[model samples]
Target: MARATGIRGIWHSLPLERYTSRDNYIWLVVATVCIGAFMAAVDASIVNVALPDLSTYFHASASLVSWVLIAYLLTLATLLTLFGRLADMMGRRPLYTFGFLVFIIGSAACGAAINLPMLIVSRVFQAAGAAMLQANSVAIITATVPASVRGRAIGFQGSAQAIGLSLGPAIGGGLIGLFGWRAIFYVNVPVGLIGTLMAAAILPKDKLSGHKTTFDWWGTALMTPFLVLLMMALTEGNSWGWTSPTILGMFAASGLLLVGFIFRELSFRAPLVDMRLFKIWVFSVGNFTGLLSYLAMFGVLFLMPFFFERVLTFNSAVTGLILTAVPLGMTVAAPKAGAMADRYGPRLLTTSGMALTGLASLLLAWTLSLHPSVVMMVIELVLVGVGLGVFTPPNNSSVMGSLPSSRLGVGGGILNMARSLGMAMGTALSGTIMAVVLIAHGGVEKAGGPKGPWIPSTRYSLYVLVALSLLAALLSLFRVAEKDSSKHESMPLEW
Candidate 1:
């Protein structure tokens, strides 16, 4: 009886009555969620800029220091589904608020790290918190906002992410230059604290699926090993050699684990992920295309800095400034694309966006030179960004729309997992291709100047990325079907 009373009191604290007008309340929720979205996005990208400085400080090999990045990404990717399931079983409000606290603590720990291992450990904690935040970001938005403007709300969230991403290089570079690499991690503490407070005060209480469901421990057990092994294989493939015994063994092990996970999910009474969700063609196709879109985007992001600094002889600062075009384009296009997706179906916009991105990549592959013009590079990146901007919100909305409210947490978790997987794959694949091609061009290691095998190898990698982008476009155009826009409309009782 006391437990029931405590639940009631916490529910009452939601303040829905205070914001009796639904429209005002909806925007407030968006405002609150955007804070977390922006901060998480910023942190993910900011660390890249600080990596070299960190390597110098720790006096570590590039491969070892890379664990700083790999550890965070690997932990975040593997745990996203688990946390999403927990959010449904528990409550998003408390979990989200707790995530902020955990993230703040992790950030402080990262900042205070005495060595690389300590920093890597802190990053693991940071990624766990990030998984909690990301797994529910879409689910919470889907629950609160009216379906009529759901796309727009999601668009604004995407814009917030773009804003965060755009600022990361600038903020990260400045912080590192001014204070040190530690300052980059320290910046999150204050921002995370504010977000935590706002989440506690402003976010509405989540209604636990109006029914009790057992947590899928068996499925989670299978999934954890599957994802970790797969991500490790992908991340280490460049250094380990694709055909090396260790890399091959990891891949084979991941495949077996994946098979086990699929079997468990299908057989389990309370599966962490409902295998049937993939049978919804829209959900499945949207997710696949979404993964491909991110793969293409991050492929360019990973490769371009090399192109800028090594080939074009630009400094890191200039390269950082130039990269802003991508996110800026995303910020500009996302909201408009969201609004458009609401009117026309997502099929046209998504297909067109992926097609455009492929064309942009092809253009870069064909036209890029040893001394590529800054204007041309910016235009290409902006086009890629715009394509992603147009594709993501609608794609995400469609995935979330296909699921019942009860399954939104798991569905969103799956969607985010695709994204994280895509990012890792893109970076790994492009990096691998470049490394192989450069190695084949024997003079690359000796040539500090741009004239060696690196330039052609970079171009060839872009060619491969173009193919991947076009393949994604084909999938979007052919596989994804037109769904009822009304499917996204707000249901009063669900909220």
Candidate 2:
């Protein structure tokens, strides 16, 4: 007990903050937050690359093994809002610090899993930890950083996430090849520990409101099941048959729950989500366009792997390398775009970014028919990345900037929830479109197996993405122009 007390004292007494000036200190906080962002993003994609090895090792069917990914997604999606609100009510520092500890423990558990069920369960635990981290990251940035450089700080965090996501496949494949599938999970342990310490040491102390507020337990109950049901239905609709009773029931139930949740929030004293935040033009439109932006981005990501492997006949390594071009472009563009948004308003940058992405997607569709060279393909993908990178930071800055400091947590949660929904929708939509296209063309077997159907299916899917991007660009124009950062800082939320 004495040793424990002594260690705790030492932990609390670390004078890390004294080393940096105020301006530099905020960037340090941003850097610390990026660790969580990077780790969570990495795990999301890393497990995917090792799915085949996991199936073989466990002697599980592909359908059964997919739950490893599905379980993580469902769990992460369900808890983000809850934890985000908790950060508001409780405090971000403790929640974020604890999140790191939980993530580390979950990573270790995942690495040590001996059976398929065990692995799936461990993934759920890991995702919960990830939810905690993600829920608080943007809120922390919003509260700590100066408004002048907010976009740039958010851009760095986004860049970290993009880089982590981009590297996941390469890292997972290399780790699996060198030390088997477990290595991918094991890799998080050391990094997570460093993040934990950094978070504890560097993060600003949370400022708690003096008045006690009730947690919207009823709101959470309704919202949680609504999201789970909605996500399950969206993800499984194709496999379960779109019109099947099971899928229909899930969708119906989810819709009713959503309505109930909306009603509950409107009536509650302290709602889970402040319903009035939507009244702000920037908040509502930003989220809508944010969803569309990710929908287009992930749609392309989902379709490209199939196109690369089947149509282009590329190996997994080469496909992974080529795919990195998208995120590589994002990494390069996000910081600069963010800094630009900080100077000029988000309207022009966001609108131009999505327009660029729409043009790039159209070009990709055209290139698909031309049997384009590898260099041309990579260049096109990079252009798409640059567009998204440019769009995301500024858009996220606008959405987050529009919120009051008191509501930043829930706002950030809603922002991330939109992103998750967009990704799920993108994957489902792209796959469904491809399947339908192939079906119309007499199916894959009838259309000369893998090669023939893939090109047309992928081309059509890219066309849909182009439309989505253009629509997002149109929506970007609707946002009320911000003459200065002070406008967002004092933006009124109609109650």
Candidate 3:
């Protein structure tokens, strides 16, 4: 039977004519993606501020309350590649629109939760939506926009994400102060609704390559357990004792699962992640550098609140406001960096950015004080943000631009996974290092007063970040050689 070629078919055939002008439509896609990016970034940080309130409300221990964050991050981290693959198969438009709806529903449920379990469950669903949105955000932009402006578009998105993350604590604190912790979740409902409608209306339809698509069930099955166990071990190692039986068991299990996953991917015709992508020097280096960037970024983010609150005697509100300098600097620098990357290649910009970041880390370590000057703190943070801001756009552009359109979704997914993994590692590493150092000094209490004890640990962690940043800078310098870098030059959009 012949299918009726009705309104749906016509709509698909004449997409651009039906919508706004091509340039406007491209910007619309960028705007829609930025909204989703902002929401994801905001949610990632906003919940941290609300954790104490939730702990008080639920009368739960700190360890249990911590799962609220862990569950969401774990779910998000593991499923990013899965969702990105699905976006390629099923079409990014539908997946992205559905993600917004799912996020809205999850946010509402979280706001209405009656217990910690319910809240945690809602967060898992929230993360699922987040994975969907993040997985497709870059792929969609790369597909829709012209190559010339792609860096600029990606940079704007980065700025939006940074702004959301940087402002989250302030927003969360204010909402919790006035309306309670529930308001933190409820706040996303309206924004999510708007994003959903915008995505549905404006996103370009997926141009499937007519290649036969197949799912790598075996690969996915092995991969999921590997990630879960590995992340659990990393996240819980500090509290659970790194050498404890449970941690050892998780490491062993994860190692075995990773081996199985590697075998499965090697044999499978359509692997969940095409491991061959790593063979491309640009792709591999870009992802690694990105991981280092986030590792440093989140390490700083995780440690700074403690510095402000305990060392400087600042309140939550003050700490959040002070933290805003980081993203403010990012927002200011990112777009210009992107445009510069478009004019020149990413090599110089990214290398310089990482070098600046390393310098800032060293400066912060030297300047760190029990009672630090506010001006100095702000200067260090702004420098870090600016460095990251300069590094992000060009690096992302190179990664996304390196792959063919067929692999863009997966490439973006892998890129995002690196970021999430870096964040998880950063938080865990920073906390664990500080705790160990503080303990070595006979605990925070025995060393001196609150600020006095923490300063050493903090200084040591910054030194670690300086090393990471320098390594990243070294990697960026080799990302592409000057003569052979013509491949990164802008070309016409295929999608």
Highest lDDT, which number? 2
How would you encode candidate 1's per-residue C-alpha lDDT over 1-495 as one tens digit per residue?
A: 999999778656764556645558888888878888888888766776555456557875333455676667667767787787688788888888888888899999999999999999999899888878877787788898899999799878877877998887667767776788898889999999998877877788788875665777877677777766766676567667889999899999989988998898777776766777787778888888888887787677666666665567655556666767777777778878888988886878888888888888888776677666778878988998898888887788778887766567667777877887677666666766776676677534221534556677777888888888777777777655435535433422131
lDDT of 3 by residue, 168-287 (tens): 877876787678889989999999999987887788888987665677778778877787677667656766898999999999999999999888876777777677777768889999
TM-score of 2: 0.81
What tens-digit string does per-residue lDDT give for candidate 2 at 1-495? 999999888766653657344558988899999999999998876765565456557875333455676677667766888887678778988899899988998889999998999998898899999999988898899899889999789878877888898887667657776788899899999999999988887888778985555678998899878876776676566557889999999999999999999999888877777787787789899988988887787677667766665566554455656767777787788879989998888999999999999999899888884266778888998999899989988999899787776666668777887887676566566766776676577545121254766778888989999999999999998887534435455544332
By lDDT, rank the candidates, best first: 2, 3, 1
What is the full ranking by TM-score, best candidate first?
A: 1, 3, 2
lDDT values, one for every candidate: 0.75, 0.79, 0.78
TM-score per candidate: 0.83, 0.81, 0.82
RMSD in Å for all candidates? 5.0, 4.4, 5.2
Flag the better candidate by TM-score, 2 or 3: 3
- Residue pairs with colliding backbones in model 2 are none
Find the 10 residues in a row with the least total lDDT in model 3: 486-495
